[model samples]
Target: MRDYLIKATAFDGQIRAYAVQSTFLVEEARRRHDTWATASAALGRTMTIATMMGAMLKGDDKLTVKLEGGGPTGPIVADAGANGQVRGYITHPQVDFDLNDKGKLDVARAVGTTGSLSVVKDLGLKEHFTGQVPIVSGEVSEDFTYYFATSEQVPSAVGAGVLVNPDHTILAAGGFILQLMPGATEEIIELLEKSLEKIPPISSLIQQGKTPEDILNLLLGAENLKILETMPVEFSCSCSLDRIKDAIRGLGNEEIEQMIKEDNGADATCHFCNEHYHLTAAELDQLRQNGELQ
Candidate 1:
């Protein structure tokens, strides 16, 4: 099925939940970045979580998630908006390692257990809202769960997973986030904890062709979940050639002239999507004449 996420409430709105099947979305990112097995898992997990978080917003609101773990992969950055746009990159996309003791992708080894996970939200306010927390686990899900409980002060359960194929493609990718609202009873929390314990890993469920609704049922019980909305998700980049040209123009006339003199042209590549944009010498001259190259 097409990649999409579902927002829902359970137990009469005391429990807020989100679930998504992001196989195609994560596969697109892997193809764009040419990420290896471990890197694919790491990036896929982050993207899966970011897509769900993007659903939390309305209008043009957007957020950027940064995981700066001092590991082989270095830093992982992802941006998502209410419109379901997302783009991300890893400092090192070729990093790979042997599976962990659990026979799973060694994400912790690739992402490291040290550093922090930070989220910066552009809520259209004078000052954006930023929250951060130390990486409790190099696994992306736990780190996000920690961010919510410690930084956002919301009790949450977060689960994300990505399975990579032997050919270095994505096999499955998906996740879920469930939060307990105020007035949540102790009985409800206990029931949720039990339900979470019995549910399979999100990646495994996706590999089994389980849908987002299946994931929610696994977490909140089949009868308790009340579907609210479903939103399509994908790997989308907002970068364009014009945006790159504007950036080069902002480098000032001196820099533009130096480029025209030393190099016949200029080339720019977006880190998020790896899209290359080339600026011709004639175009540079025109920008200069128009005083666009301050």
Candidate 2:
């Protein structure tokens, strides 16, 4: 099915939950970046969770997640907006390795045990909000879990998984986030923890064709969950030729002249989408005139 995300609350609103089925979106990303199995898993997981977080924002608000783990993959960057859009890329997308001890992708090894996961949120305010925490496991999910608990001071449980096909495409990709609200009793917390442990991996469930609703039913029980909102999610990038052209103009007339005089043309590629933008000599002249007007 098409990728989507669900927002819900359970146990009489003591617990807030979000889950998504992101196979299609992940496949698109894998195809775009040509990521290897392990790298695909890592990037897909981050993108999945970032999508969910984006849904938490108000209109025009957005956030960026940056993970620098000091591993072979270098860093991963993801951006999400209130409009249910997400895009991400890893600094190195061709890294792969054998399974971990748990027979899962070796994400921790590939992401490294050092470095940090940082987030910058633009809430339509004069100053953006920034939160950061050291990488707890280098597994994307646990690192986000730690970020919520430490950086945001919200007790949360996060699980993200991505299974890759032998051909390097995405087999499955998904995740869930559970947060405890104030006055949540210990009894409910224990029960939810047990339920999470009993369920299969998020990727396995999505691979089996489970919907986001089905995932919430398994974790929070069909009888208890109160569905709040459902939003379609996908791989979307806001970068475009116009935006790149504006950036080139922002470099001022002298830089544009230097490029036109020496390089003959300009090439710009977006980090998030890898979409290349080429500026011809004529385009550079136009940009130079615009810069002079500025």
TM-score computed on alpha carbons, candidate 2: 0.97
TM-score of each predicted structure versus truth: 0.98, 0.97
Task: List candidate 1 segments past 4 Å from native.
Answer: 291-294
lDDT of 1 by residue, 1-294 (tens): 899899999999999999999999889889988999999999999988988898899999999999988889999999998876788898899989999999999998899998999999999999999998898889999999999999988999999999999999999999999999999999999999998889999999999999999999978888999999988898999999779778877888889888889898898988998888888888898776654433
For candidate 2, list the clashing residue pairs, or say none: none
* Per-residue lDDT of candidate 2, residues 1-294 (tens digit): 799999999999999999999898889888889899999998999999999989889899999999999999989999999888999999999999999898989999889889999999999999999999999899989999999999999999998889888899888989999999999999999999899889999999998999899998999899999999999999999999888888888899999999999999899988888888898888899888873322
lDDT of 2 at 223: 95
lDDT (0-100) at residue 140 of candidate 1? 93
| Each model's backbone clash number | 0, 0
- Once fitted onto the true fold, the runs of candidate 2 whose alpha carbons sit more than 4 angstroms away are 291-294
Q: Note the residue pairs that clash in candidate 1.
A: none
Candidate 1 TM-score to native:
0.98
